[model samples]
Target: MGQALALREDFDGSDLRRLARGSRDADQTRRLLALAVIYAGGSRAEAARTGGVGRQIVRDWVMRFNAEGPEGLITRKAPGSPSKLNDVQRAALVQVVERGPNPKVDGVVRWRLLDLAAWVWDRFGISLSEATLSRELKALGFSKLSARPRHYAQDADAIDAFKKTSRPAWRMSARRSRPAPR
Candidate 1:
């Protein structure tokens, strides 16, 4: 039993209908049409029916429209969860990755996702899973790359010396022919 919200007087039913016609967003257009019904002296129930939404939703649309005009009716993507790393932490992470790990100090020849996660936990006190760390790395423009494994005792020169230099030439034998009309 609260007082009914008033629609903005600047735009009338025809203006809303025209805006709806030009709008690219289907949801915005639908909302505009519904509000247009209200502007045309139609009941909230009628507007709701036109919009294919409930009366409460129509009321919300009216409030949004009143505050922000036609632009407010457009649906927007929801803001997702905030990043775990702040700017300073992210910069530090980037620097660590670029500088590479020291085997003597960090106990690793190359950085793995597990090692990175542990490093983050130790440095930032933030526990991140391997997958989450990988995702973060990827978002920060890092790709997973590993050098091909080679045996410690393998000799490159010996391998080159055993390799075939050229293809072996084949010798063809002369073929005997039969009489054509026999």
Candidate 2:
């Protein structure tokens, strides 16, 4: 039920126990609750009420149980595509980064993700996508480092003098402007 009450109905057959053994998903738990309520002589409405799902869903599971029993409660997995990189490739990539600076191609010092991906494919012969490679690096406590422009006042005295003398007097500008012809 939506509200918690301390009513203990006569539940049987360890359906909930076995469902708990399978997976901790909400669907499996709901199915088990439905079976427990209805199979133990509780009404379809009462089953839905106790299980906190709609009456029709409870009735459906009851019908499914009647047809296939406990095995009927098994939930199907969500369909999807498979992953790209395997454990071995991930390990090799991580090792290369942790070992530090990459070899010079044309004299650029450090390695980027594409460079790492290329190196990984060349050395270990395992092609890892840049996205997956980034995830692996983050999981291993590595973060991207970048540089910011620094304002280094090398000669503060010279800079201060330049700023002070940089402006022309208002009187000088006024003197430089020729009056409009009458």
Candidate 3:
């Protein structure tokens, strides 16, 4: 068997436990507690069990702790794929959205996500779903807004006058519906 791993002499079990308690991250707290157990002469396997991980994981943690201290115990984010649309394209898209669509050229008065997706496909050869296009537009600070539909010949003044004058004959109806007295 290999030689045992050594923890820093300055830190004891209590100090490790205190650090664990102070940590906001649960994983970091668990790793600190595991290291505390190891510092108290517990085996790597026991430390792994305490930390809820495999023995190899405990070994890795110990190495990180030795090299980088408590800061190294925290988890890091995984790098994902880059966005499909580049900065220049996104900026252009924003300007186009701000300008609105041309009814004569685009065939539609409003820019629907479906229309935008089709435009993107035609302009850049990028196939985009309506939902994806919507999400991208929202991320660029655009919100869904549609004008209320009304007939072209509708008069707002007439509608307001009708609302003011219209009243159901509730008093006559109530008198007619009264039961005959005994």
Q: Specify the highest-lDDT model's number.
A: 1
**Deviation in Å, model 1, residue 100 alpha carbon:** 1.2
lDDT of 3 by residue, 103-140 (tens): 99988888888888888888888888888888788888
Choose 2 or 3, whichever is better by TM-score: 3
Q: Candidate 2, residues 97-139: lDDT per residue as tens digits? A: 7676645652335768888877877777777888877877887
Positional deviation of 165 in candidate 3, in angstroms? 5.6
Candidate maximizing TM-score = 1
Kindly list the per-residue Cα lDDT of model 1 for residues 30-85, writing each as its tens digit. 99999999999999999999999999999999999999999999999999877788
Q: What are the models' TM-scores?
A: 0.72, 0.41, 0.68
All models, RMSD in angstroms:
7.1, 13.3, 6.2
Task: Specify the poorest-scoring 10-residue window by lDDT in model 2.
Answer: 2-11
lDDT (C-alpha, whole model) for all candidates: 0.93, 0.67, 0.86
Sort order, TM-score high to low = 1, 3, 2
For model 3, the superposed segments whose C-alpha errors exceed 4 Å read: 1-12, 59-80, 150-156, 164-182
Clashing residue pairs found in predicted model 3:
none
lDDT of candidate 2? 0.67
